[model samples]
Target: MKSQGGHFNKIIINRILATFLLMFVAIGIAMFLGIPNPETLLLIVLVMITSIFGMESGIVSIVMLVLYVMYFYSAEHSFLLYNRGTELAKVIVTALCSLICLLFCSLVIHKRLSKR
Candidate 1:
């Protein structure tokens, strides 16, 4: 039983990493396409990912959120470049929206899984 649980955990970790990478790829595509609100697109994608992948999506969402914020801070010269309070506010809002979406997605996924 213990080994089974451990194996399950490992699978979840792998799934999270896979999902995170996919999210990054999608972000890259959005950036290239000049999406007016990549953050919103990201949140929508995250929710869909969670809905499809189940609970592991929460971890994926968190990793993506952190990396997204860091990219904004480090990119220096990009749409996400944040040099003022207003710019920073956009990041904050994106983070909050991601968190909310993750929570709702998790709950929905959990309920669905429990039914199985």
Candidate 2:
């Protein structure tokens, strides 16, 4: 447990780290679900989370993304999945919706934190 909640820098750093960790977890889940180019999406997610959170999370997430990409591409078996046009469109739509929701939640949190 961290007791230095009053320190703004620490709070931001912690939030970033947590966001990155979440991004990696999300990428893993997506991989399990047969998503393709998980590394690229992971990088994007890391950027989004870092933008919503901070630099530390973005940097760390990118690091993990790089590692994953290396392993993913080097593996004899495919780490990414391929989909048809319709499926790709569907995935894009779902990703857009999810990003909207994430932004909405981030806004709410930002508002609440600003009020404090």
> Which pairs in model 2 have colliding backbones?
none
Q: Native-vs-model 1 lDDT? A: 0.74
Model 1: residue 31 alpha-carbon error in angstroms:
2.0
Model 1: per-residue lDDT, tens digit, 15-93? 7877888788878887789876677677777878888776576667766765665465444846455678766777777
The per-model lDDT (C-alpha) reads: 0.74, 0.60
For model 2, residues 9-98, the per-residue Cα lDDT tens digits are: 778767866876787687778679877666556746765775677555555665566555544544353434423455445445544544
Q: Which regions of candidate 2 fall more than 4 Å away from where they truly are?
A: 1-6, 76-116
Q: Model 2: number of clashes?
A: 0
Error of 1 at 47 (Å): 0.4
